[model samples]
Target: MERRVGEQYRITSKEIDQYDDQGYLVLKNVLTEKELKSIDPIFDHFVAGNESEKMGKDFCDMSQPYGTPIEDFQLVNAMLPGKYIPSFSKNIFYRIAKNIADQLYSNGKAAMDYEQFLAKKPTKAEAEFSMHQDLGYWPKTKNTWTATFSLALSDADVINGCLYLIPGSNKETELRSHRPKEYGTATNEAVNRDDSHTLIIESKPNDKIIHLPVKRGDVTIHDERIVHGSGGNLSPDWRKTYIIAFRDERTIAEERAIGFTHSHNDEVDWNSIIK
Candidate 1:
């Protein structure tokens, strides 16, 4: 989709420093009231559409139900509604996300890497987001500035497993080896199980961890290498988040990019295991 972002989204020097140093930044009320209102019903509609049983992998990817039996990870229930959900990709959110990506990407031009709605169904607090860096999974994404903007559609707090990230994790630019295990319809998330959900850094420097209890209109943007994950939802309502990720346009082509699979039985196209 060729989108013209007439108005550029500019961040302050402080925000840039935060993102550069900490590998993550949280911005509140990114969408105005009108935009929020526009997005609300559209997001609701997408969530409702996830209830259909006929969603395919390329379209609305409504995965296994919350109670699917799994030994490796919880049956993670999620949906990537971007390809089929017209309202979201056509609305202001898509444009705004791209604009932000365009501004942050080293090439100053970006393409949509992916979009997904991660949900933690009520009472299943083990949301099963095994912690890992995004770039580790996407080895072919090439070295460029890629970022993920996770916009909060619902209140993502401790109750609903809000995002948590470690500061300055991006200082180490090397992409650590990630185990390419399919977490059972959870995601094609490359995982470093030992580093999941915790950050232990012994440094001659200060260390910080941030837990975002973001409101409806807030967003958390993080670099592809930052260690990130969230807990499960203990709340009564479904905890849903809208994730829009972008990589440099040149990095996402079929040849440059590798396919990620979400099923345990599915095999990755390239070599991912250590002999």
Candidate 2:
């Protein structure tokens, strides 16, 4: 299953149907050992160095208020690494991801919308991301077709903060009410502080939640409207994930016009906030 450069990862019709019905799908062994190894130094250089603080944000729980102490922050997220490390965008994983996305998209084409690194630190019980849909963080557009490909850089399991999503949640025509997780009032228009990046939708007690655990190099793809989140890394090991998202080029431009930007945008002065 070690695909070479330029080799496409074909998506079967059955896989596409499943994604349509369930809002998420997992593809195993999409990256070879060599490809995975090639990313090691990049992750190390950022995670183990002071530069990470300058380029990324550290937070505890998405539900917590902003300004949590740095040492108490259980998750470290660096967005758009390709901006600083050109090799990231040049990786074979991105090409294969685009290939797969092309097959899943109705238009038969996709563009690289954004990418990021999310690392759950070991033994951080409060590191969980609150339940939320990707669209919750974006502006409403006529064509909401987009896919996020999350590649596991470390073995992901329940103990180590694997993704959990609600089945068929993507079918909702209207966006659910979402507010910054720390907001005290129940208002759909609750604006998040400039420093806070998380918005959450409250899940009902009867929702069917599915947790997806994958081995290193496996990738999980999900729709933009899906209600999803991950748990804390209670294990003694890190749960590292590299996420790349694809969308129609037109949709990208439409969303940008409405002042919508990803939380980990390179344009932000993250160093001022994180430090």
Candidate 3:
């Protein structure tokens, strides 16, 4: 059975309102070093597969931003590892994370929908994600309001490419047009934004961008519609993040679906993309 809100986690009403207003909230040291260590064995298993270039349904490899068939696309993103490694689902980290999601999502009533893990290799410092909403990639879901939790298994600082959010970006309930793949294509917003000032550039308007440099056990929750992405890992430490996504189970958004299902996992080559 799933957990309910206000049962195990203690979050102030004010904090919930803060998340509503700013589109994100950060909880400090939600797990201890020992708690994080309990998850290491599972992560190691995925890492081993990734290091060996083993790509599969669960072990997903990040494609080169250019969407080529060349030798560059090798960074790995392991999905639903808990399903493959049962110990991962039963770990203390999962329990604490689930409890937190149960408390903060859907006015403290949402349930767990999906979870994934991302390991940013130190050498893949150039493999950064474009600023876009998670909703753009997901299928027609019954819930539109999703609470995404990102827990850092290792220390994530600006040097190691920590996550960042565009404050209040989720206020618009409409889904923006996204490119076909995680390749370096810009969203419709990027293409249509006012061109007078070079609207979208690397870390542009640095003042408005919120960089999340969290430590081990730190968790950051953000509205799924918020424009969030991370920099490339320039540091030697591996940036490992465990992500849990929660949904209201009823908030649906299919009216604006533009009918594109191509995502990062699609095996389309660069030449096939309609430029």
Candidate that would win on TM-score:
2
Quote each prediction's TM-score: 0.72, 0.85, 0.73
Off by over 4 Å in 2: 1-6, 53-69, 183-191, 263-275
User: Considering lDDT, where higher is better, how would the candidates rank from best to worst?
Assistant: 2, 3, 1
lDDT of 3: 0.62
- Clashing pairs in model 2? none
- Cα lDDT, all candidates: 0.59, 0.76, 0.62
- Which stretches in model 1 have alpha-carbon errors above 4 Å? 1-9, 49-54, 57-79, 180-208, 254-267, 270-275
Number of the top-ranking candidate, with lDDT as the measure = 2
Task: Report the number of backbone clashes for model 3.
Answer: 2
What C-alpha lDDT does candidate 2 achieve relative to the native structure? Answer: 0.76
Error of 3 at 124 (Å): 2.5
Which tens-of-lDDT digit does each residue in 1-275 have in candidate 3?
A: 22223324466778788888888988877777777787776776776564333334345444343223324433446666655556557456566766766666655356555677777777677756556677655555555677788889888888878898888878866655555442235564432111110112233454377798888888899887787787787887688888877676443223224332222233433322222
Ranking by TM-score: 2, 3, 1
TM-score of 2: 0.85
How well does candidate 3 match the true structure in TM-score terms?
0.73
Clashes of each: 1, 0, 2
The CA lDDT at 224 in model 2 is 87
lDDT of 1 by residue, 6-54 (tens): 5345666677678878888887777666777876775666455443344
